[model samples]
Target: MGGEGENTAVDLTAGDPADVENDNDRIITEEFKIWKKNTPFLYDIVMSHSLEWPSLTVQWLPDVSSLPDKDYETHKLILGTHTEQNEQNYLMIATVNLPKEDTEIDARKYDDERDEVGGFGGVDNKIEISVKLNHEGEVNRARYMPQNPFVIATKGPHADVCVFDVSRHPSVPANNTVRPEHRCTGHTKEGFGLAWNPHKEGGLLSGSEDMVVCYWDLKEAGKTVAATRQWKGHTAIVSDVAWHCSKPTLFGSVGDDKQLLIWDLDEAKDAPVFAVPNAHEREINCLAFAPHSEFLLATGSNDRTVALWDMRNLSQKLHSLEGHRGDVFQVQWCPLDETVLASCSSDRRVHVWDMARIGEEQDEEDREDGPPELLFIHGGHTARVEDFSWNPNMERTIASVSMDNVLQVWQVADNVFNEGNEDEEEPADDDLE
Candidate 1:
């Protein structure tokens, strides 16, 4: 079945060592002649770039607390060119000066901890490092890459955090570089979520696709491995997990079974705080808590609806805002504004909804068909909107990632980061996916 050209003439395109060496010899001779003719200038230019290759993109994260009178740095983009690569995925943290101007919203007060070794990096697997951006906003760089990084969750130094790494290899694929790095038995299934405990020292929680949520303690040994307690309830795949910002004892998970299960990290109990079956009509793709409200939660689904629920009053639907005809992939509430919720859908639309205005105008005219009107429908992605994040440090800044391999930063309005009292505005009708 071999082609006739494969064994015959010198294949210039093939990567054979003999052929490549010959080609390099010929090119080197021609380059040497040109370099001799160019003289001193060629030597200087050739010696200039001896360090590293040029990167595709460069960016700086914004400082937030330095901004005047902002309670939370929701307007600042703390992560610069924050990319999550499939092969070498890393949470890169960088530090730089903020733009200086009168209207300049640079909050550099938190720049003292610009030290590395706090961000996460891993090769060939979804190994999330539980590192945080220091005050100066830099990542933790090591001489050699760390190993057995299963699920990382940050706590005070000494021994703090958890992470999961590839423990087994199935078969060598076309991409030979992506082989599994290790073989170990830690969790029952692959880890899906990691969160640091805000109240306790070296306390954290990790969830796996195995439908188990484990409480971990890393206060003993540096980079330790162990679980104190495990909580189980769901019979399906657990997709995501998150700790309640204020409630350290409680955490949440959304899964493939289209259910939302709330787990209490405290070992005093063996069951969930609350289990809501049929939470989403479809698979729950993403879930986020209201950064400012403890009783409020948001969930996105493949059903194209972003549901807002009030733990206080769940007798009926609080607000089921449906605009995207495709799956609503991810959702997050503004850290500074509990009423502002952002959702990215497979329909390629990133919508920002003002939950404070939900059912606020439920008159006979407006409630004829749908719920509250859309606050803003963000556009730009040429393909499905995979993920988007609102900067926790700046004002009204949002960054989104798409399947087109592009990331976009959009400023919604001038210092209007918390539009709690603004009138709801309906965007123009445009059917684009």
Candidate 2:
């Protein structure tokens, strides 16, 4: 696959070892500058805030705060930390400052009066902790109950999910500690899979490395919550789980077993109602159902590919998206765009895609930019993108957190998705499996 000398040479191994040694620092600085200069061309607005430590997950609070005198809007974030053994880990709430909804939006910039000499590296970003709770262990994952945003749940300390009414504590510093009011315990090992049923109040689902999924009813239970039911069909660790947006009894999961399964609580708990074995060439890391189109599903995997599948036909995938060179960690359908979705990966990139643009004609530049459906590629983070979510309250907005402890909140350029394109029909739903 190597090309000629003009751009050829696969790597640095072609010359004398010492002379060929790559200067990573030099390369990184150069790359950051180039990307920052191009950001304004790609983003409508962007904010890059760094945290005290990297969070394994990030979620937007349902509400946004607007102050009369300020030029920016304030948004609260739900986050969890991963720290060294000797350090204290926490479930945290942080507030970010953003330019008030679209009066004026710009791109990444640089100033000599910065931390790094070439610092567009989170320089203009501002964020601060609003509240922090002492977690029993590193937070594996965190989610706010959909129906009631004030109620939050965190997974950690070996298969336990702690439920907290976050409103109980005032907006205090990280030191003024509060504890979870209830805890759900059952699985034998730790997991990153945790979700709340959107249509059902107090309904929670958690899966673990123990190859089991537990359904917890947190409403009537006391301090220590127990699973009302458990499912045991997965042969390996369950990587992620999701509850259907409109169906209270419907849910889905993907796992290291290379399987995608659909579950209905109204049916037998011991077996999945439908499953697609080998839905991916490698184990699936995460799956999300399209919120607007109930029949469509998106999945990311160790295969470095993102697959779109129609639940009605599991025998083959509708599209196999190829670009990421590393394992994809999270794949989420945007709340505001029915045909749009985003995926984060171990390759240190966050890619936004649009299904409606698939197979479209492209110019030379567009042809070189991966796939036509790959709307945008955010290569801002210096480390693996751990997690990301679309802003529930804004258009084309996304918040992504990374292993480098950076949290970027950016909105795609309106023209990126809307230019010259009329609204197309929502993906056909005649085939809801």
Candidate 3:
């Protein structure tokens, strides 16, 4: 894996040989089959896109209405770059257009055989829409509004949070007429993390190096932007923040101070409802609240460990997962499954975990020392993976961005594990010998 400081040229259209089944594909295919045979799930690399610059964040837009008379949906991806070159920090919106005829054929094939190998082939054609922001700062994070697909929010090594309106010019080559619609400046230092309130129409939250969190209401537009409320609690820089999916007034933040703080808008503005000090041995990098459970939370740290917590019991952690050889950068829960989650790390691997199996194991104190139960490990990136996103509408599909300047999309194969096979025994040693 390469360091973050390495600079690379823009190569947006080049495709990886492994993405489509080339010479190196045989090894990957065999390994994938073996892994799927032993595990309960399977995955395949469906698409790969090269970038001109390294990206620290990638986000998938919400599902949109299909084009008129077309049976396939048009999906879009937003990539935020991190670079030292002047004006190299850009935001790109890549649209994947699948032909209806090819999609129908693939669907029919999958329905007939239902094999792990059969599905729509990798996407070879896509349209790229890009824009250069006014500030030449590293983009640490980017996210789309829950209610509006056209609106996006980004923050980085700048004091202000930038908002872009993609509808201004859907097809890019942006001119002076199309620019960032708003710049919300309140933080005294560079911003690190950002999250949109899932339940609020125009509410947003941002964490910064200034050790403060600011809340903004974008519902009202004006010449200048200001935070509706701001709070300070952490003694160190805040690394990430996330809003609860079902609770509009609740949110969480993790920081370099090794603390996880939970805030509520309806309560006192100055203090948090629950503060878990020393959440990890090292700086906490990122966190996400479970989509299905309001009390469940997950956090990753520089200590190379991920911990799951129950908000109802702040004193004890539900589980501590350790497998990544390097720092854990991001963790996300599957939108469709309550017991599944995924994580990316500086070790250049993406791992998927099944909490149902983990819950059946003995507690950390009683169990012997060994790696946690990991369902799958994706070793496709040549460099450290910085961020990844799960598709909201698709089951077992995910997209990840890496410092190698590549974007890869992976999807789990259907019916890899046969029903009622959990009780089967392995072959005898004499048979293998």
Candidate 3 lDDT, 84-192, residue by residue in tens: 6555466667765533433532322212122222244443354354444433477788898988977888887778888887677445454434257888878998866
Give the Å error, residue 359, model 3: 4.4
The C-alpha stretches of model 1 lying farther than 4 A from their native spots are 1-89, 94-101, 104-186, 313-316, 360-373, 415-433
lDDT (0 to 1) per candidate: 0.48, 0.78, 0.72
Can you write out model 1's per-residue Cα lDDT over 1-433, one digit (the tens) per residue?
0000011123356698897978855644454343223222111111000102111121223333344542222222212122233222222222222222233322211112321111111111111111222211111111111122222232111122223222232212233232222112235755334455656655656555677666656555343465777677767766566667678677788877888877776547687777788987888867777778888888888888988777666444477888775798778787656678888877656787776666565667445333564665554444566666665554454666555544545445331223343673322223110
RMSD of each: 17.3, 7.0, 8.7
Higher-TM-score candidate among 1 and 2? 2
Q: Can you give the TM-score per candidate against the true fold? A: 0.58, 0.87, 0.79
- On a 0 to 100 scale, what is the lDDT of residue 64 in model 3? 45
Q: Please, what's the RMSD in Å of model 3?
A: 8.7
Q: Write the per-residue lDDT of candidate 2 for residues 1-433, one digit (tens) a residue.
A: 0000011113554677665545434444555555565554556666677678889999999889876866777788899888877678888888876666644543434232421111222324456787887777788899998878888998886667889887886555346344788888888899988989988889999988998889998877799987888988789999999988777899888899999988998885479988999989898999898999878888999999999988788778999888786899999999988888999998778888889889988898557557788877776676789999888888888889999888877776665556554662221223111
Instruction: State, as a TM-score between 0 and 1, how close model 1 is to the true structure.
Output: 0.58
Please name the candidate that would achieve the greatest lDDT relative to the true structure. Answer: 2
